[model samples]
Target: MGIRNKLDISAYFVVGPENTKGRPVAPIIRDAVDAGFTCVQIRSKTASARQLIELTGQASEVIAKTGKSDIVTLLVNDRLDVVLAAKKQGIKVDGIHVGQTDIPVDVCREYLGPDAVVGLSARTHELFEYIKNADVSLIDYFGAGPVHETTTKPDSGLDVDGKRITRSIEEITTLSRLSSIPVVVGGGVKLADIPSLARTGVAGFFVVSAISEADDPGHEAANLVKTWNSHKR
Candidate 1:
């Protein structure tokens, strides 16, 4: 199946490193899949290309072995080359997630073709407006946040004036309603915040430290998924 078709964008989303606070990527992915997270983005910023490919390959194996390969979509953050490299090595990575400074979304679509999942980060209204005019056919989803201050991504959060630079709930709601693609919110999203975030009507939530730093990633993921699911009920 195509990545676009396979992805349940409304489900829980998880982003992390190969070794998150001593937790390995493979088991974390397994736990995520079992806990009903439908999307995983491998964001190993400091790892080399070979290391990323190897790590993603392991994650792909876990997804495949657990029989969630068709349902779960795995993406490599800002590394289209790694995604292509992994494919050549027989690892099934779904696509790439890019920031404004990364490759243009259209270029990514041209390289990966229509079926590849392309996610772009929209932290400001201006960025969201730009995304609104973007070619929806080439994009899968929009990742909007650091809903609160976050340490997961060193570059995330507010600017010099102490303003919340990321999209607010009102902005998210407007974007969710206006855009054709799904919108997933991220950054500093904890279990206690899920209920309120869910009310914003985003397709889903993106998590990192909340799960990666937990002593039990599986349980943490399960709780997150459960909370997300409850909102739909």
Candidate 2:
């Protein structure tokens, strides 16, 4: 409709085990809800279609039981069909998040249909520009950073060992200010850095390992949300 509203600065969870023996995705999500996390996206790459459907089904229930509209968004790391199937099943999720390797935003829109809250990740400005035409309508929000090197996605372009977090924030904030779409920061975000990140002016963030693999993911989720909100006021 009108310019999309500013994104929620509260915690947004990304569901990937990251091989850390962390809590299962379902319970972690349940706890995320309990901890006041406003949004979630399942970002697993290893799970098959059947597995994802099963997982999202459980997540759907959690979202419904809690009455968390837009609280849970089912995002496939790079799978569009999974996203479409999740939608067709009437699985209640906010939307799907995708990245460079996934289907083009236009094709995703054609198949997933309008109204799907599609997100794209951009590590470099060129990659961001790659989706400029796509961003016109096909994309809803953009994830732009690992702001620092992260073990989370070691091979991806962005990620500096906590060193780049500020620079990444600077870059994405600049992008978000100029563009109409919301830009979110991800990768190597830490509890102490949330306020500085907020000062950058991006709408919000997508936290993966920081929340998922934390000693207390739910509590960690809450802290990030709290920190982000404090910065807003």
Candidate 3:
């Protein structure tokens, strides 16, 4: 079976130097995985491709040291070229996560091949349209929502009118019901929100600042995982 069939994304950690407040991305990733984060996404708006490849190599190594790399899927955010380059250099990157405007999912799947896990970013309002017309045959999962408003990616969750939008519990439940692939939610999610969000029937809870900017990322990640395990459907 491919990794997607058995991937454990219950506590998905998204991180990069940009989110780490000047700390190296690899150590924070190591801490999160050790604390029970099941998946990791390497994301950066400013890092060059070469820099990202190096970071990916570091993260891959740290995750390996934890001895749970089989269950821990590693993905690079929005940079298909970086993913390809990292793979070419023998780094253990699993796949790529792309937004609506980034590289198309079909092309990503084509290059990365069938064994890779490809994720797509789907916004709240676009769920219906995505359900109707999105070619999800190539996708492994849909990441939907800033469950609350967030500044991590300021342009995200905005409406056509440029107003900030957030996903309500009801909306999230509906999304889970309608999506063909597994759905994971993020953006402003925290420990307290885990019980309710987990009960919404979504597959996982993803986070950026919750773990990356925490005073103790490992402890915070453990708590988040603990909360999800206790309440997840």
Q: Can you tell me which runs of candidate 2 are displaced by over 4 Å?
A: 1-10, 19-22, 70-72, 123-135, 158-166
Measured on C-alpha atoms, candidate 3 has an lDDT of: 0.89
For model 2, how does the per-residue alpha-carbon lDDT over 63-159 read when each residue is reduced to its tens digit? 6777765534545666777766777888765557777667777887787666567788764535445535444567877777766677777655533
Better of 2 and 3 by lDDT: 3
> What TM-score would candidate 1 get against the native?
0.91
Output candidate 2 Cα RMSD.
3.8
lDDT, candidate 2, at 190: 83
Ranked candidates (TM-score, high to low): 3, 1, 2
* Model 1: per-residue Cα lDDT at residue 200: 78
Between prediction 1 and prediction 3, the one with superior lDDT is 3
lDDT of 1 by residue, 71-129 (tens): 88889999989999999998998899997779988999988888888998854535566
Best by lDDT: 3
**TM-score of each candidate structure, all chains considered together:** 0.91, 0.84, 0.97
Clashes of each: 0, 6, 0
Model 2, 221: alpha-carbon shift in Å? 1.0
Whole-model Cα lDDT of every candidate shown, in order: 0.80, 0.68, 0.89
